[model samples]
Each structure stands twice: as C-alpha cells, then as structure tokens.
Target: MNVSQIKIENHNPYAVSFKTNLREYFMNAASVEGIPTVEYVSLEELKFLNSQSKDIRTGNITINPEDKEEVFKALNIVDRGEYFDNETIKDAIINPTAEGMRKLVGITDKFTFERVYAQFIGLKNNGEYDISNRVANVLERRFDEIQHRIFNTKITINEHGFKPKEDIEEIKQKNESLETTVQELQAQLAELKAMMVTASTPKKRKSKAELVVETENTTELDEVKE
Candidate 1:
C-alpha cells in the first residue's frame, strides 16, 4: 500500500444525524438535563470554544471523571449496556430503520470515548458520565445485525422472483374475459328492460274503420229483422 494513497480511516458519514439524535436524547434524560438549563444549540458557547481551538470543526477538550459523572447524572443517562439487551437487539432487528438504533450505532462507530466525553463536557460543567464505551460495544453488535440484514439479499420477497411477463399476461386475460361477460350481461339487461317497458304500456283501442264495419253489420241485422 502506497503511503500517499492511504485514506483517513475514521471518517464517518452520518455524524450530523447522530449528533442531532444525541441532543434529543440528552434533552429527554431524567436527570439534570431533563429540563433545558439553557437553549439548545448554544451559539455563543460554541463560538467561544471555536475561537479557542485550532480545528474548529472538531475542537479538542479535556474532561475529568467527576465531570463525566455529573453530565451523566444530569442527563439521567446510564451505560450503554444498562439500556441495551437481547430483547432490545431483537427489536432493533425487527425495526432496523429505527432512529434510536441508527444513532446508537453511529455514535459508537464514529466517535471515541474521550472525544465524546469532551463534547458532553463542552455543553455542561458537571461530569460523571461516559456513554462512549458502553454505546460503542453494544452498538457494534447491534450494527452487525443491521449490516447483515441490509447486505444479505436472500429474503422471502426475493424467493417469489419477479415473473412480470407471465403474471401480467394472466391478469390481462382475466380482465378481458370479465369485460366481455359484463358487456353481454349489460345487453341482456337492456333487452329485458325494453320488454318490461312494452308490457307495462296499455294497448291502443280498435281503429275507427273496424268500428264502422261492425256498425254496418249490426244495421243489416236490424233491417232483416224489421
């Protein structure tokens, strides 16, 4: 492998989405973070930090254990393993597209414990929390399932392979037959309706010519009697 061709191995694509979910989860924490101590996306604080760091995009920070604990305590957040289990894994498999599963896996694969801890510290003063290690381990396994499901193309739907031509022809024939039957039935119904209309109307009375013929025969019979 050429040294010049080497790629930075730690580049992660879904970082923005991961960070957004983390913010939401932190807001929901039952501890200190349960209520917004301040507004989300503290622009002033981030700007100050950005000014201090050489790499503003991923600024460095130092966090002590006590600080970690306080941050975790405030967020009421616990270790990754504390929250994840076999049942959770099963559910994650069933709902692979879930945001929580995606975020958990993204955080684990994208960021280091120290770096993540620093991020938490940047937002708060207290520390006693470390989610990176636990999240990384649990998510590593969970993400494997997601990867398998995504890449493994063998599926129930696939088993029924796409027979588009045959299936379409079958449907087309059924539709044509049904249409013909409907047309024939409609014609028969129209004929029956015409017959019913004709039967319902009264017949006209005898014509005047027929009445005159009958009157002449009656007069002849009267004259013969006289």
Candidate 2:
C-alpha cells in the first residue's frame, strides 16, 4: 500500500490538495484519527504540543504496560513462564510487532494488536481514542482466559509436548508387539537347545557278558575272531 499511488475521489473537481512535508502533522478540530477521522493526517499545533516534546514514556500512546492504559487493559496480562524469553513488556511497548505483542500478551494473531497499536499512535498524536467494537470484544479475551487459569492471574500460553492419543496408542502397541516377538524367539531357542542335547547324547553300549578266556596265551578278542 504505497501512499504515492493512491488516487483520491474528488467529490468537487475544484478542490486541490496542497503539498507540504516540512510542517508537522497535528489537529484539534477533525483530526486524522478517532471518531471524526476525516483526514489522512492532522493539521498543525503549537511547537511544544508536538510529539517530539514529550519523553519516550509520556509521548507513546497506550500500547502495552509501559505506555498508557487508555487503549486497553494490557497491563493486566502477566507473563508467568519463560514465554518472555528474557524480554520485558517495554520491548513490546516500544515496538508492537506481532511476535513482541504475542510475547507480551497471549494473543495468537497480530492483526488485532496492530489495530490497537494504531489507536495507540493516533491517541499519542492527539488523535481520537475510538475503538471498534469487533476489535474490542476479543481484545481482552486472552487476559480473561489467563485470569481464569490457576490462581486467577495472567500467564503465558504454553503449547508444549502435545501429542495425539492415536500416536501414543501406536507406540504402546509397537512396544507390546516387540516384547511378544522377543518372548517367542526365546522359546524357539530353548526348544532348539533341547533337540540338540537329545541328538548329541551317545547311546549306552550293551553290557558285554563276562567272557572268561581260560587260554593262557590267547585273549578274549582272539577267541571272538576264531
């Protein structure tokens, strides 16, 4: 969305837009933001009333905990876990990007946060604090959910180690199948060992009757051969 390419509809062909980038944008009448958001930019204001006159904290519109709480009740959100990742709400206040907003607040989408941020900026520059009802409805949803959890305090939404029941069941079944296979293999090995032992046993030799060869010069085996 380039501002240069946009062509405005001229209800009256005689009206012309003046070009001036040197002056600061401001308004107290029908400003560029909020209820009577009639213009794309504000008109002009006193030198001290400029946004540059305010400090970093005071100048910013209410975007998060660090800024004012006019836009919404963002300060109610309390990050319980390591979801902050060592980041403070000030980071989100300074730069209300999707990720920063997600970390600060438990909201999933960035569009609503961005919309609220626009209001933050608009109000900062003396714009209106008009909030759309649609955005307002779900704005504090995360805060409410966090308050409902545990000890009724805000917390980070942790989505970790979530597995479907089917996957867990499959793993359990696989383990059972493996155990059964091992048991079968052990039984087969024991049977094979018993068979080998039976086959390898030597048959007992028949007891030879006492053959007493009374010959003085011949042995028992010589008598048998004769």
lDDT of 2 at 29: 30
Candidate number achieving the greatest lDDT relative to the actual structure: 1
TM-score of 2: 0.25
lDDT value, residue 50 of candidate 2: 28
The lowest-lDDT stretch of 10 consecutive residues in candidate 1 is: 5-14
Q: How close to the true structure is residue 124 of candidate 1, measured as C-alpha lDDT?
A: 30
List the global CA lDDT of all models: 0.39, 0.37
**Number of backbone-clashing residue pairs for each candidate, in the order shown:** 13, 1
TM-score of each: 0.25, 0.25
- What is candidate 2's lDDT per residue for 35-92, written digit by digit as tens? 2211232212211222343211222211222222321222233324322211243234
